[model samples]
Target chain A: MRAVALGDQTTYDAGTLTVSSAEAAALVADPALAEVRVSWASPGDSTRIVKVLDAVEPRTKGPGGGGIFPGFVGPAMPQGRGTTHVLRGTAVVTAGFLPRAQEAVVDMSGPAAPLSPLGTTHNLVVEFAPAPGAAWEAVYEALRNGSLALAARLAEAALGATPDAVEELPGLPDAGDRSLPRVAAITNLQTQGTFKEIFVYGRSFGSIALPTLIDPGDLDDGAVVSGQLGHPSLKNPTWVFQNHPVVAALRARHGVDLLCAGVVLSPEPVDATNKELVSAHAARLCKAAGFDAVIVTKEGGGNADADMALKMDALEELGIPTVALYAEMAGADGTGPSIVVPPTKATAMVSTGNYDERLSLPAMERALGGDRVDVAAATALDAFELPAAVVYASLSPLGWGHLTCQEAS
Target chain B: MTTRVVHYINQFFAGLGGEDTATVPPASKAGAAGPGRKLAQLLGDDFEIVATVWCGDDHAAGPEVMDDLLALVRAAGPDVVVTGPAFTSGRYGLACARVAAAAAAEGIAAVACMHPDNPGIDEAGTAPVVASGEVARQMGPSLETLAAAVRKVAAGEPLGADDGRVGKIPRRNVTVDRTSAERAVALVLARLGGDREATEVPLPRFDQVTPAQPVTDVTTALVALVTEGALVPDANPDSLESARATRWLRYSLDGRDVLPAGEFRSVHGGFSTVWANEDPHRIVPLDAARQLEAEGAIGKLHGEYLVTAGNGTSVGNARRFGVEWAADLRRQGVQAALLTAT
Candidate 1:
């Protein structure tokens, strides 16, 4: 994987990208969308992007037209292979309201800036509006596909440019390393309803069989796409899946410290029966693979915690050590219990942070995506103090950033 | 301007007497008492210990006496409240913690100091606590910690994380350099190596409730339908919030045989609610309940149904709603309820 840092440029020159709004709209033309507006929000800009649907880092694979998101944009081929050029420090942000969507914001610079990675990235904000009589599902479908196509087009700018850095992600080593501990990862994907699901290779995880296994490399190549628009702080965005920190962490010490076994994707359903069923399936798969330990993390809110607890309990009961990661909605003061459901046997857990921590955001010089932000009262305000949960991917359940919940005396 | 402070202490701390005076009632004196004088010196001129309140450990332990003592403290109207340096004294520590907690609850800045393992630490609640030593020998240092904490709270500054100056309150979020992924890997490695590393989030204990007795005569019971599915009239006359709702609303089901499509809609953000919109009975099950009523298999259904959106609501709010809902249902002679959750 190679990354080319994007700087201020009207054209692709010296690691800089110049986006043409006209060309970008043409690239993702769809009948579901009546209009598509392209704008930019660079770092240090006094800007806030509201109603965020999803964010994707621009990247393309190889010197050819092959893209990173294989099934969505390029041919249906395995990812995490060959030379993939990433337009680092830049993101293609999809902004639009989905039916029954909650509020999500990203401040370019302020007290809320550190909450989301998009706050620091050079964002190409793509705002999509539905056409007359367009069904919500059709509009959402177009938004997801159009955004991916736009991301691929933007990443093309990095194809002929010089890369700032190159990273090598090696495949799994031979199973002959008996001394090393074999560790794997389980990512719980939110698949409750429309606009609240994750697609693996263009197919929703809910549609797949229980405890589906995917190559860790495919995740890096953008096989996992996020469609969840529930809670911003808890939901996993597309970018996090592409640059999975947990997968990277395991891969970092793959040959030396431990064996990077593989990654399993589990669907977090709403009801209790399905939650337990999926958890059991995931645990059985891990046990069958002879995993020494597994790291479990979830996507979305408290509902996922129930899924995490069941998964952890199933794995621990099967004699596999599990480390679970979660974010807390422990009220505004951080005094409430972090998890809605606690695992009986799983003791090792990592907290991403408290999503309900209050933050005071100052009025920005400019606002992008929308004029009004949907919050408690769904009003337009220049400055306000609200929960950190409103920020996009601030307290990411996947632990993409460094924010954490710690005890204060 | 100097910040005024109300100081709280036990009988021994006030030098009023020892064990025998432990049963004495609450008393107050103007300005600094025994330890308050030292605390005053440590606090410097920026703070004034305007009043000192003392109570017998035995008397303070009583609920009514504690309330009276809190009233006296409230009358002082100090900028901040500082309690104890209770050290290893269990009863004294408990009194100090309760006093601080009460003062803080009333919006007064409050801090308490005690040994970490003091039995009273559990009663500290959300009050900020400073760490102290196990014995009187650590009085000077403990007072110093308390004085520092008073200043910070008085100035509306939060206690710093990981600083020994304060005792544990609850978990707070902070931005660190390493992501939770790195931390998870480290924890995994530690577990694999047979090391017992503490989890960042302590396991929470949930309260258990015994099931209510089933209705003895279904034909004579008044069955109420309740849901957390946020099903409401199309206009939502009560304007119930779509999510994180703090209040529940009741709608009349007086003359309707069915909750027809387009007449009612679900505002719940947790689920798709498409089918529920097509037919609200999937959520409230009102149609089936009505069929049973018409067939004389059960008593007549209640005239109204209660609903609230459960998504993103805090446990505290949910508990309050449950308590209120139970009272309301019982007052209306609701024999049993069918509560559905989203």
Candidate 2:
């Protein structure tokens, strides 16, 4: 990769595309590509590049026009010739493309002037893309195929991702089954120093009536859809995975014992009232669904007191224990209020993503494998060997050509 | 002789108004004020409705409210003070618990009741009596429990085990078995209770802590000011974990002479929305490595600054990260670290 960039041309070697500085300079010399920037993606991957450009025309309003005008008329009738000077910069180029394996191509090549301070912001972006026949092929192929069945089977056999494996056991009958003790689940709800108890039921498990105060329609709408499982919502509109399901399922299925919930809060205040309302509604719904507690999953959005207060009020009112699930929001000793409290009745289960139902079965199975997982587990899983191989399989149509039956096996 | 009792009710129950009226302090009114009438009927002739006091829950929870409540209790001159059987209501339970505890402290027998789900059960449990079961409509059985409680108080009987009806502490009796000679000696000792000098009890002493000396040189000294302030990134990088357990990234100063204050911004993992201008001199290290280098604190900034969102990072993780980061910095010939704990 380094050699190609230094060689004054694009070259694909070991699944990496390298562009020479001379090529980049030449591309920038072109008028049409003047504002473009240079970026790269390894073979068989899509990479988005964004460059802010200076000196651009600004749109103006016509006299007596209350709204946007339809088309461009000859330079406005010069009454006073109002000249607008652009500061900052404009984002001119936003493009992405997937390259073929072992194929070296310049994903993005252009020129952009320097801005104040950083001395002409020139950055070479290189994104890693999977190569054909890599180990991650299985996982990538499964997703590309949208083969829920194949995914389910592979997940069940290879990773133990099964419905029975994910369902929490305490919600099941007391059959003195030894597996009962191992069943655990964690939600990503942020509960403040409160206790949370959750009861998971199977599809066959009779429906329990939610409190009348909570509407049933909301729950139905919030329920995890196919392909988007394991995602729970504090706010119905913007759904994410929960933390407790992972912990709960682990305890319920793999004999690894622990129960926890995840909480997600915007680090900043969100203006979406619907999100807030749904969050408030979901807290009540989850409680009515027999959750012992709720925790807020901390997503690094901005935080608003109104949003936090609303969620807190709902959980406190429901008599549910609330704690913040600590992942990567802020350190416990960091500046402000923590999502989770120590010695809190709330426990923490480290996982990837908010506790969404869509990821529940797979995540639970992952937890069951008894791997030492951390906050970076999701990123590591995304870089899993099988996923790389699957990506290679899907991109075979681009140039690498499909693997033969014998090769696939 | 019937035991005289005074009942306390909030302004809403007193029919004064809603939450707005709750701000008013306690005022004693003659016979059967609002809910007091219903309570009177439930108590029957065994209890006399002496006076009823009306106050807001906030007033009851406030210190000033206690003064007025104490005055009302004195004026009512009742043998017992009985407050609500507040069902799942939070403020109501808090008010009842406060008044009941105050009455007990004044040597007046007090009793309060609430439903099992009431939040006050935990807070009010330390008081003289707290009866909990169902709602007010189940007052017949509740009244019997209250009556039994009053009888025990009047007869000077030790309060027994509580079934969550009255009082926070459960009743328990301690029985001491002794031989005849020991019993005689015990009886004589009891008779001479005040005169006997018991064994001296030792009190535990805490070790004194010395104050830490102030840093002499700002340039050389590595000052770490740990704050529970919110230092989240503009884009909350970790959206999956607790707000407390965020990852800390090592910031580099990028060969700059002076650190730019504006570069240091906080994400929202705090109680307040606004960033704290804690100290004018305190600089947030957006590019920490460079700043340290400029200050001559370290030889060279090394490695990618370990980055973790701190929103919901746990104390355990924070400590671990701090130790790990410190260790890594040490390996890179870095000396003197300034850890800004948000």
Candidate 3:
């Protein structure tokens, strides 16, 4: 896979990634919208930015009309294969007051910098001002789509230039060494109900859903996108969807330690019977696929921990050694029980980190300005004290991050 | 300034007559006495043994023991409480654990050492207990462990995981910094290599509480409805958040037959509240409870309902809510409660 790894102070026309305040105002200049604002942001900015809805990396499918994140932004197409051009690092971040309950903030510098990529990467910030009459659903759609369109436009600059790197992920072997352990990963998506959601191949999941297989290739090509915005410290961002860490981690040791049998795109069911039904089917899939072991990961929030615990129990009962991964929502102090319904069976559990730990961040020198800044009202304190739950700036817990431990002292 | 310490021990360790003197009552001494001298010597210049409290095992286990001991320790005003390195003596071990618990309740740093097989080990709860051997011969090493535990607890140093130079009872609910993916890989590799790594989340130990006796006659019993389903007044007067609720709303239902559709709604973020919002009774069920009251299936309905969003609600907050509300219901003479979950 070829991707253009862009750097800090990354450029569009030999200058910094640029967009006019006037052009930004007009781009979101819907009659329904009160106002819109945009600006270019570089790493180590003086101030912080808040109310981030989503961030999209600029790229035009390695040199074709078919864009990244097909179905939502462009026409549907199979990803992972072929040359996809890249303007890798920098992204267009959407800032807005979402129609639903909450959103996230990204600190560009200070002690909070290490928590999110938003701290390191240069950003083109687009802040939205919702009008009195503007519908929330319309606002959500406009900000998301607007970010993608900006990404494609930026990719036009890197079209004729050569890519910085090429990554190779070989397809599964028709026949592998008999001793290799077949491993399947179950991405436990939190699409069971309500506001938070995840999209698999452009379709939103809810209710009694079954597991679907996702190719490693498709995963690298934006097969999964997170629609859920709450619980930001641990949520998977669109960038992680394009370059999945689990897929990358597994593919690294694919041939030697274990064979990447396949990925199971599993959605959590809200009720008990549905959870049982779906998990039981997943156990069957493990057996039919001849998987020697499986890794289970969950998208953050709710009682999805129960869904993961039930799924692990099912697989373990089948004599399959399973690994369960999640960000522990153990509340703000880390003294509470780590999970809602913990598994009784002897299963290997991995915590991504506590979503509730607090941090005190120093004020930044510059702020990536936004319109109608009610995001300020979101916090009551003047000091930058926040829970670990708010810093998805790095898209951790669900992706590449520290391995948190729950030490009983 | 020196850290003041109070050491507690039993009659035998106090150099009082053994077994025959077991019925003697408790006594408070001015400074390091008997084994307290050894612990005080080991604790170094930073810690000064201000008082030593000794008692017969039977006397310390009696009803007034904890109060008497607390009063003695309060006057001594010690920075830390070091109870017996109670070896194999079950009665002494139990006494020491109890004294340590009392000290902890008074917000004093405390440590208790006992043999693993002693009955006190399990009952010590979150009190740091240094594992001691079953014989008095182990007192030297046991005191060293006890001193270290006291110092660590006093200094507030993290003691679980590989920081094992000082080990305490495992509290599996504390979270540290590590991502789940890395943990998964390590665990997977360990499994494949036929090895075991400690789980990030140890299998949770659940407490089993006895259920309350059921109300034999609903026609005469007063019933109240409580829910973590996040039912709130239309305006959300308390402004309880959609998730991670720390506060609950108590809505008055004294004269109401039904919760009007727009007057009540599910403010929860976890599930679709459309159906619950369409008919508020689907969650809190005021209409149904009223119907039961009218039909004489229940005596009287509590005039108010309590609600909070349970999704990702912290165990601490939930516990506080349960305790505070249970008292409120009991004060109102409610005989039974119906808890609804979303």
RMSD of each: 8.9, 29.1, 8.4
TM-score of each: 0.78, 0.27, 0.76
Strongest candidate by lDDT: 1
Tens digit per residue, CA lDDT, model 2, B95-168: 67667767876788777766644444434423445464466567566656656666566455556556344322
Task: Report the Cα lDDT for residue A29, model 1.
Answer: 69
TM-score of chain A of each: 0.94, 0.28, 0.86
Computed on C-alpha atoms, the DockQ of candidate 2 is 0.02
Q: Give the top-scoring candidate (DockQ).
A: 1
TM-score for candidate 2, residues paired by index: 0.27
Candidate 3 per-residue lDDT, tens place, A243-359, comes to: 666666777778878887778878777778888888888888887778778888776674677778888889888978888876665556454556667876755787766666666
Top-TM-score structure, candidate number: 1
- Which tens-of-lDDT digit does each residue in A1-409 have in candidate 1? 2223323433567755777778877666689889988888877788888888888988777567575797799777777767777877888888867775788888988878877889878888888778999998888888789889888877776566667788888786565656799999999998876788898888777733598777898887799999888987887899889888899889888878888888998888878888888899999999988789999999877778888999999999998999999887666656555678889988888988887778888888877777887564544348887787788888777777788888764
lDDT ranking, high to low:
1, 3, 2
lDDT for position B337 in model 1: 92
